[model samples]
Target: LAAGCRTERATSVCLLRVFSVCVCHPEEKKSVPSDEPFRVVFRNFQRTLARPVLLGQGEAGAARGTLQVSRHQDHPEVCVYVDASSTLPFVPPKTCAFLGPLFPPLFSPIASFLPSESHGVVLILDGIIQCTERDEFAYQEMISFLPLCCHPNPQRVLIVGGGDDGVAREVAKHPAVLEVHQVEIDERVVELSKQYLPFMACGFESPKLKLTIGDGFEYMKQHEGAFDVIITDSSDPIGPAESLFRESYFELVKRALKPNGIICSQGGSFWLDAGHVRETLDYCRKHFPRVTYGLAAVPSYPTGQIGFFIASLNPETEFREPARQFEDAEIDQLGLRYYTTDVHRAAFTLPRFAAKALNP
Candidate 1:
């Protein structure tokens, strides 16, 4: 509260346009310790902010301090705000990848917690982007449709963690799907996605989708042999997502699925970390009889790519022949851009290097 003031809501930028020169350093939840000075958004308010300025930052409750300009001893008076506890931290005017930019990385948006009232995309660095309209269909459609199409008729599908992304909506596109049950650990993701990311958030609004805000593992444990297809729309394999990859979790998923159920999960990128792909596939192979790998290219995701680990309970389940094939007319009716019947067949064809490394 040095010179900048806070209103009833959080303010990442100085309200005074004249004092707009600012320093933005956001500290993601656990990646950087909260005690670091960079954890707060440092805003300097001044009519003429021409010189370099450095101000000592203590705790949030510390008394307001003055900005010590390095060049001029009699520098213009300035006010600043060090808000480490802001509900929605600001990271300057970042590139809204959805809007496209000259250099995408430089203008990339900050993925942090969005304000309760906000309705646009929020870039949560720790959790990553919450599905953008530009490329969400690539990942969600591939992950959801690849498994659903493999099954003859997926009447009951289980979604592990696709709370807001339009995963359930894509699953519902198949007319045979009677119900889609989703278990998300966090409900805020659903609420935030509904308001901000309306394009992908339609998954929550689908009548076939049944959302449960609870532990996906426990939910599966209680409902055994119930689902025809299980889709795990998880984030990176860290923290909460770490558990989903464990051998025990697969046991729960096995129990939850029908006799010939199909399962698909977000496998890590092939280019960034191939070791994770090999290891996670090993976990899937141990539990299921037939298992294979597929990938989708999404510009927003890390390495401009993401992959899927698909496994089927029945050894006879043919990955190639979809139970219900979609004609060109049907594909158009579904409004699908990335996923076509041919794409489904091609996704499983591993690259030469991948074939040698993963299959060999």
Candidate 2:
């Protein structure tokens, strides 16, 4: 398929074919090998449908391929079809296959509804699973509350690249947060989340939220010392989010934060890439006086886990211990599913191997 190709869905099966030109941007053209293979995922099987329909025209349509649908005995509702001769380089393990088209040249956002055992629905961008409804709270709560609770007073908050709005939802739950400003480069992710994943998208409806669709780096440059807390809910260090993990981005974040400000970002999973995690922390330490790495169990993410890089401008700031602890009743009142004062402390306590790799 081309870089930004769209797949059309039928009653039960989705038709995805390669094209010479990008669907989202017609001005760009991508060349594909004739024998290149693409995988197809079929889920929510209600009834048998017609065979896969081939799309596109010319050599792109006539590309040589074979489709084989394999169903597991445990999960009869889901089936995966792949071209036997080729390997799927993009699809992640345990993630539902996407049927939507890629959006924008920089980011390919795909949303898929999975079987009940896996999750309800997921938002995937650039072949990485961003959020699943079942376990999204685990990530959203930790990323938002970790920094908010670490800060003594986090009134004005800024969220960078949280297009799904999950971070906004969790940030708004903090009573100390008076205003929430979010900047997302891609508007399609927000619109798609609102349409397919309202549970997270509802965060956009919060009265305290003031969203600005723009580049977070540029946005932060213009708003120096404006926010008490800044959370960067970005993807891995690749594609459109690659710059988010750089030293320059941390410099911008430091400039945008107040004197005592605290910030947290979506640090890559150590299990997947420890060096990248350490590199990100090094960048953070250069800008902030105190920096800590926290982990969360997000089943849908790679390795069934994800980590966050939390830093504070105050030299004495303790990220492991929450500055503001919420009572059990207060936690219930805030509709918190995964975060607690104790959990906040435990998240920063890394395992032996992780501590050695990250701290060293």
Which prediction has the highest TM-score against the true structure? Answer: 2
lDDT of 1 at 258: 95
Q: lDDT per prediction? A: 0.64, 0.70
Off by over 4 Å in 2: 1-99, 109-118
lDDT of 1 by residue, 268-355 (tens): 7665556667888888888999988988887656446678999999898888777778999899998888888898888888778886
Displacement of residue 214 (Cα, Å) in model 2 is 0.8
lDDT (Cα, tens digit) per residue for candidate 2, span 1-360? 211112232113233443211112112232223232343233422211221221111111122343322211233232333342344323233433444554553364333333232355655443334666679999999999999999998999999988889999999999999999999987877887788789999999999999998899889989999999999998767546788889998999999999999989998677656777899899988888899899999765645678999999999998877899999999999999999999998998888999999884
Per-model TM values vs. the true structure: 0.68, 0.73
Clashes of each: 9, 0
Query: What CA RMSD would you report for each candidate?
Result: 13.9, 12.1
